[model samples]
Target: MKEICIVEFTSNLGLKEPQTGKEPGVNRLPDWLWKHNLHKSINPKNIIRVDPPKYSNIKDPETNILNADSLVTYSREQAYLINNLLSANKFPFVLGGDCSILLGVAMALKQKGNYGLFYLDGHTDFMDISLSETGGVGGMAASIVTGNGHEKLTNILNLSPYIKEENLWCIGNREYDDEYENEIRKSSATYISLQELRKQGIANCTKKFLSEIQNKNLDGFWLHIDVDVLNDEIMPCVDSRTPDGLTYDEFNELTSYLFQSQKLSGLEITILDPDLDKTGEYTKDFVNNLTSTFNKHFNN
Candidate 1:
């Protein structure tokens, strides 16, 4: 059996300041989860921490994305660490600072071979710099990975477009602005809205994603989950709170099914801000649900 290896990277660099004008609290994720015994429950094969670059609110003048230089250097280091971990045949379960960390994961995969992505988030995260109001890399991460943004962020490690559009499946997106033109909708990547998910059923959606990616015959696929994808009522600790999202049961259904697929290479959970959830009630629940699911599926 493949052993689970945990990668903790609590970074807030991908986000913009909220009304507080201070750095968002996404950096506190790894600590918060561990306090709730998330790691204790999993008893992973090994645990490694990928330190993030210092937080900066100023957007990079060069890439027009916040922390551009730091993110590239950070991702390279992260890619090297994860690449080594995966090389040992351990399942790399990356716990993120934010969606921006996906670049490192993509780079690691690119070095090995072609890979697909299963992107689960409340927002599509595929906006261009022109449409982005805050210039946060987390907001436009989908676009960068698919080679949509500046060459600096997209062409890291001399590899442009870490993930092929047709091989990617962007799911559970409920946030969209009718005012701005939708780019992901027009792209080759598969886009599944929450409404569409309800109509089609979660099981069917999961099966379709796995089936389609398998047909592509890629090396494998990675799973990306931003905690905001859960319903706002139960998971309000996230950075960008929206009106509706997958319920805890729905979240379990989708993730458990996806994790069961043998092609699933790694998973990174992002965007849970401990600064928002001081009581730890929300954090405890999230940890319980997520760890239980992981143990149920893989630790069996």
Candidate 2:
């Protein structure tokens, strides 16, 4: 039996949109999922909470990433906690406040050894601060992990480039700005757009991806799933929404392959804003899907 470690990251400071006297509500996610008995179903060994440092409006002079200093501090703390869990041989199920949490996850794994990244999101998240209109760290997460962003973020824990570009694989991305797309083309990281995923079929695409990862002989890999990857009609709680994305069935199939691959070192779910989940319908549905998927794959 796999011992799951539930890690809650509560921080919305990485959001580009300034707080208008209201919170992003992403911080409420861990508790909300727990209300649905997420941990009970997974039989987690421990639940760890990594609280964010006090947020500040001040952007870093060099990085131009909003709340840069606070994000770094929070990420460091998260890395420490995750590393300890890894050392204990626990599989971390990280519930994130935003996509920026990927930085900390990568940092934790980097300290142990090399790892690949499986980024499943609506957007590529490859923009640097210079190319980013809002300069949110969330938008630059992939770039940071691949050593394409500011040193403050990419060089966390003095480990430059948390994950290798060749080892990074992105899928389920349906939305992309011109600059972001161009950057991805230039980078060594492999990107399979939503259109390509559809053309090849989810099962085939995923099998091929996993085969490549296996062939590379990577130590392990982290999976980052931003909820925005779901169709906007079904998942509208994110701050950024694209028109169309993976349906519930498609997402389940994709994750099923990933979990069964047994190559996943850790997993993180991000960008579900409770503020937009007014009637709690979206949250309930998301929880149901997540639990079903996990149970189908890892609950044995």
Candidate 3:
């Protein structure tokens, strides 16, 4: 039995206020994600909070630890905490301050040994410091895991490469810079688009993805889902929501199958911008989907 551990990281990362636009009074926004609400929504009463360490602000965007500190320490703490929890037969399900928090989950899981990574997001998040149009560290987590970004992050777990390129599969990515596109081609990673997902069907695509890994005798698989992959009409609480993304049922079905795969080692859910959520519709959907998936596959 895999014990589910939730890490609440409701950080006001970098002190950046929520962006303008978005309906008011929606619980989808970040302001209302209290532990109590999480308890009511997700099963398993044993949840932990991983608060980020304070960091100093710097003028240079790249040098700004205030925002980047969370990204670096996220995996460090996650790795330490989850290793112990997993030893006790628990599976860590990390909730986010942003997608950057995945760096920690990756680090934590790396301790179990090399495994495949299934990244579902709107953007590739493989941009390096030079390629990143936005200096947000969340956009660079993929690059970091692939050993392209900050040495601080890649060096985690003391492994030269935190994540092997062959073990990575990117899904639902629609936007990318020319450099990012080029990197994807050169790298050993595989990917399918949101349009491709809709055309081929999420289950078919996921099955295909699973086929590639089935031969590897994977120790486990990590699932990193960025809410931005959903169309803003349904999940408008993200900083970068796509126009043609998956529907709630579509996402739910996908997660249900994924959990049922029994290969899933851990999960990390990120980039839910509660600031933009209008009527808590996003929260309701998120809670329901999370609840349904756990009950169907993990409640035994």
Candidate 4:
């Protein structure tokens, strides 16, 4: 049986403030899930938290990014914690503050050796900073990890391209930016649209990813789930809400297949805003679906 380690990243450094002095609710993701019984559901072997620096709404002048300095600092701290857990063979199930947490995990994995990434998010998150409409680093996380951003964040701990393009797979994207999607298409990372994933059948799509990773003989792969990848009618508590995405049934089937892999490293769930789920109804549904899925197949 796989020993799971529950990790909580308490940072929203990647997101833009909704208003002056107003922070994003994604930072509360771990707390919300815990209250909804995600901890009880997993009963993980370990629980860890990486707290963030004080919230700053000011964009960094040097990098032209929001909270650039703190992001670099927090990522380093997270890498240390993740490294310890990996050394002990604990599978990390990370509850993220935002997509930026990927940097820390990527740093930890890079220290070990080459690994593949299965990025499941509603948006590609692969655009350059100059082209960013919102100026949020969270939206550019995919690109940064693949060595497509400012040197400071992308080259954390003297490592660049934290995850190589050839070993990366970007899936479940429905939101589009002409420049962003075009850049991803041109990169080495495999891009699987939400429509394409559904059309190809979850099992087949997942199988292709697993086979490709194994074929490359990679160390293992990390799975990232940005909840906005789910259909908006059911999953509306997200920073950027896109209309169409995978249904709960489709998501369950996909996870069931992916989780069965022994080569899997760990998984992180990001961008589910607890503030929007006022009644906790949607949060409850998300938790229950996730709990059921984990019970049925997590590193099984």
* Residue pairs with clashing backbones, model 3: 26-278, 26-279, 27-280, 28-274, 29-274, 29-275, 30-274, 75-104
Residue-level lDDT of model 4, residues 1-300, one tens digit each, is: 668999999878899987777899999999999999999998988798879998787878898998899999999998898888877788999998899999999999898789999998998888889888666789999899988888999998788989998888899999665666898899988998888887888889899999988898999999999999999999999988888998899888888777888878898999988888998888898889987987887755
Which one wins on TM-score?
A: 4
Q: Which runs in model 4 stand beyond 4 Å of their true positions?
A: none
TM-score of each: 0.97, 0.96, 0.86, 0.97
Per-residue lDDT of 75-150 in model 3, one digit per residue for the tens?
6776788778766767777676676666666776677777889998888877656765445667767777867766
Highest lDDT, which number?
Answer: 4
State the TM-score for model 3.
0.86
- Computed on alpha carbons, the lDDT of every model, listed in order, comes to 0.86, 0.84, 0.68, 0.88
Q: Arrange candidates, best lDDT first.
A: 4, 1, 2, 3
What is the lDDT for 232 in model 4?
97
lDDT tens per residue, model 1, 1-300: 788898998777888898657888888788888899999998887889978888888888887788999899998998898888778777888887889999988888888788989889988898889988888899888889888889999999888788887877888888766633268878998888888898999999899888877887888889999998899999998877899999999999998997778888898989988888989999899999988888888634
